[model samples]
Structure formats: C-alpha cells, structure tokens
Target: MKKKILVSACLLGHKVRYDNGNVTCNDPRFLKWSEEGRFVYICPEVAGGLPTPRPDSQIRGKRVVTGAGDDVTKEYEKGAQAALKLAKDNNVALAIMKQDSPSCGSLYVYDGTFTDTKKLGEGRAVALLRQNGIKVFGEDQLDDVEKELKKINIL
Candidate 1:
C-alpha cells in the first residue's frame, strides 16, 4: 500500500475555502502523489459545519473570530479534531496545507485584527496534527515535504 499523506482540500483544487474558491497548488510532486493515490484530502472547516462563502476568521488568544466579530472557535476546534481523526484513521504522517488559513495554515496567520497583518502561528488543525506527530507543511513547502518523504522512504 502506498503511504498516505493528508492535504487540505483547497490545495488539491477543491473549492472549500471561506470564499468558496480554492488555493490550488499545481506542483508536480503533489500531482504524482495524487496519481499514486497517496493524498488524503480534507476540509476541516467544512467538516466542522461552517458554510462556504463564510466570514473571514483569525485566531485571537485561543479564540477564532470572524471579520464580523462572530466567534467560531468551537467550529475551528471541532474541525481540527475531525481532521486529526481522519489522519489517525488513515495512518497519515504528513500534511500539506493552505498557508495563512485559520483552519489549515501551517505557518503564519492573520493577527485577528482584520487589518491584514500576519503573525507567526500554526492554524488549529495544523497544531493538532503536529501535536499528534504528523509532519505538517504549507502548500508552498513542497520541497520540505519531498525531503521528509524521502527521509522516511516513502518516495
């Protein structure tokens, strides 16, 4: 069986973002992985029951708040848990996610001010995946993903 790697659905060209669009990465490695049936696509925010074309959100001191000031922390946490469960069930050890997303960002995210400022932090799902020993990378970090896969003899 091929080794499984989790990926945010939007990166795989799924229209799962809050704006109902995708952050697709047409990297050859990801294409090869998809052809090998090694990609496990997930949209945690949707899994947590948030609607698409929803409000833009950011992490604020352990809370996830939208641009309109509605708290969505519970949904984010729920989505993280669901995504983690999927990874565990599939025995996935790696993830490539959308950067700067409130639910999937593996690096910097908005600073919760709706001011377009960024701060270094992992998104909720990324943090949970890391906590459970999953190696998470941003969509732009495919080189790192390839290195890790080679290190583990998965490529």
Candidate 2:
C-alpha cells in the first residue's frame, strides 16, 4: 500500500489561512505526489471551527493567543487534535506544512508579542503530530522529506 502524506491545505493552494490566503507550491514533486494519490490535505484551524481571515495568533508561553490579547488556546488544541486524528485515520507517516504559522508551522512560530519575533518551536498541531510519531516537514524541507520517504521505503 502507498503511504499517505498529510499536507497542509494552504500548501495545496487552498484559501484556508488566517489571512484568507494560501501558500501554494508548484514544485514538481508536489504535483507528482498528488498524481500518485498520496496526498491527504487538511486545514487544522478550519477543521477546528476557526473562520477564514481570522485574527492572527501565536504561541505565547504555552498558550495560543491572538495579537489583540484574545486567548485561542482551545481552538489551537482542537485543531491539533483534529490534525492528529486525520493523520492517524489515514495512516500517515509524513506531513508537509506551512512555515511560521501558529496552526501549521513545523519549524518556528511567532513569540506572541506580534512584533515579528520568532522562537524555535513547533506549532500546536505539529507538536501533537510529532508526539504521535509523524515526521513533520516545513515547506522548504521537501528534499529532506524525500530522504525520509526513502527511510520508510515509501519513495
């Protein structure tokens, strides 16, 4: 059976971002992955009931909070759980996500000060998925993803 990959919907050109935009990629491998039918897309924030064009949030001392000081931890947790469920249900071992997003960033996220400060931390969903043993990759790490695919014999 082909191994499935959990990809961020925004990476697939979906307008499921907080700013109602997408971080679409046109990489050949991305298209190839889609052609191979191994892509399982999800927008955790959207799945967790957050609206499009919603307020931008960041990781603030273990809690997710909007720039305006509104708490969105529950929503982030809900989204994280939803992402995990989707990955597990589809038997996914890999995920390619957006960078620097509070919901999908696998590398680093805002430090909640909203002054463009960044910290070395994974987003809520990325952390949860990693805890579940899913190898998460940032969009810039597609080459590393290919390496991982070979490790799992999915390439």
Candidate 3:
C-alpha cells in the first residue's frame, strides 16, 4: 500500500494556480504515484476563500501579505491550518508543494516585489507543516521526496 502524500492541486493538473492555470508536470513518476492513490491534492489559497487567478501574494516580515502590502496573513494562516488538518486526516507524511507560490511555495518564491525577482521564500502552509514536524518537499525535490518515502517501509 502507498502512504498518503499531500500535493499541490496545480501540480496534479488542477486549475488552482495563481494565474488560473494548471502547473501540470504530468511527470510519469508522479503520475505513477497518483495512480497508486498516494496523492492528496490541495489548494491552500482557494481553501482559504481566495479566488482563482487571485492576486499574487508573498511572505514579508514573517507575514503572508499581498502585493499591495495588505496584511492577508490571517487568510494564509487559515489556509495553512486547513492544509494541516487535511494532512492529518489523510495520514500524510510527505507533501509536494508548488514552486514559487504564496500559498503553496515550498522552495522558491517571489521577492514580494510583484516583479520577476525570485528569492528564497516559503509559503505559510509550508511553514506550518514544518513546524508541526511534517516532512515537506518542493516540486524540484521530487526525487528526494521519493527516496524519503521509500524508507517508510509501508509496503
């Protein structure tokens, strides 16, 4: 049996991206895992009541703020909390988040400049997961995630 793994909806071919588009990697390796029912797709932003093609957001000064400097941290935090709940409900051990997303970003995110400047930024959901002792992995780290999952001995 395959262990549950949290995944960003966009990466799983869902239209939950920031631009109202899907980040469908459609990678054979990921698809195989999905076919095995190991994936738990999520969209933290929408789960927080935000809409599709929503305004780009980022973390600034330890808060999840929007490009306009509005304090939307509560929204993001709520989303994070919800994601955690889902993870717990599904008994997920590993999470694959979207790269460079304000809600799902795992490794790289914009510099909050609303421009094309990307720096090391973590989404609110990612932060919450780490704090709760859950193993988080960015999209780029799929290989590492796979290796770690393999060590779980859940077969």
Candidate 4:
C-alpha cells in the first residue's frame, strides 16, 4: 500500500479557505502526488465545522479569535483534534500545510494583532500533529516533501 500523505485542502485546490478561495499548489510534484493517490486532503477549520468564507481568525494567546472579536478557539481545537485523528488513522507519512494560517500553518502563523504580522509558530493542527510525531511542512516545501516521500518509499 502506498503511504498516505496529509495535505491541506486549500493546497489541493479545494475552496476551503476563510475567503472560500484556494491557494492551490502549482508544483508538478503536487500533481504527481495527487495522481498517485498519495494525498489525503483536509481542511481543519471545515472539519471542525466552521464555514468557508468565514471571518479570518488568528491565534490570540492560545485562543483563536476572529477579526470581529468572535472567539472561535473551540472550533480550532476541534479541528486540530480531528486532523490528528485522521493522520493517525491513515498513518500519514507527512503533511503539506498552508503557511501563515491559523489552523494549517506549520512554520508561521499570523499574530493575534491581525495586522498582517507574522510570528514563528505552528498552527493548531500542525502543533498537534507534531506532538503525535507527524511531520508537517508548508506548501512551499514540496522538494522537502518529495525527499520524505522517497524516504518512506512513497516516491
């Protein structure tokens, strides 16, 4: 069986972002992975029951709050948990996440200030996945992802 790879839905061209838009990865390697049926895409926020085109949220002191001041920490947590469960269930070899997002960023998340300020931190789901020993990377790291896939004999 091919090793499954967790990937953010938006990166797979799913309209799952806060604005209902996707930041699809155009890298040929991504398409190759898709064709090989190695990608298991999920939108953490959507899995947690948040709607697409929802208000933009940022991590505010352990809580995820929307720009309009609505506390959505619970939703984020639920989403993160769901993501972790999926990863474990499928034995995902690794993850390709969207960067600078509240729920999917593996390398950076927007500051709570929401002024486009970025901070070095893992997103809720990425943190949970890491805690459970799942390797996660950003969409920009497809080359690195390829290396991991090769290591796991998925290439």
**lDDT scores of the candidates, listed in order:** 0.91, 0.89, 0.82, 0.90
Model 2's alpha-carbon lDDT is 0.89
lDDT of 2 at 27: 88
lDDT of 1 by residue, 64-138 (tens): 999898999999999999999999888896999899988888889999999999999999999999999999999
lDDT per residue, candidate 4, 1-155, as tens digits? 55698999998888989999758998988998888888888999999999988999999998999999999999999999999998888879899999998999988999999899999998999999999889999998888988887787778
- Residues forming the 10-long window of minimal summed lDDT in candidate 1: 21-30
Reference-based TM-score of each model: 0.97, 0.96, 0.91, 0.96
List pairs with backbone clashes in candidate 3: none
Q: Per-residue CA lDDT of candidate 3, range 39-145, in tens?
A: 89889988887878877787776777777777787878888999999998898888999888877777887787777788886788988888888888888887888
Q: Which is the leading candidate under TM-score? A: 1
* Clashing pairs in model 4, backbone N/Cα/C closer than 3 A: none
3 or 4, greater by lDDT? 4
Greater TM-score among 2 and 3 belongs to 2
Give candidate 4's root-mean-square deviation (CA, Å). 1.0
**Predicted candidate 2 versus true structure: per-residue lDDT over 16-109, tens digit per residue:** 8999975797889888988899999999888888999899998889888888989989988998899999899998979998889898888898
State the local distance difference test value for candidate 1: 0.91
TM-score of 2: 0.96
Range of the 10 consecutive residues with the lowest summed lDDT in candidate 3: 146-155
Model 2 misplacement above 4 A: none
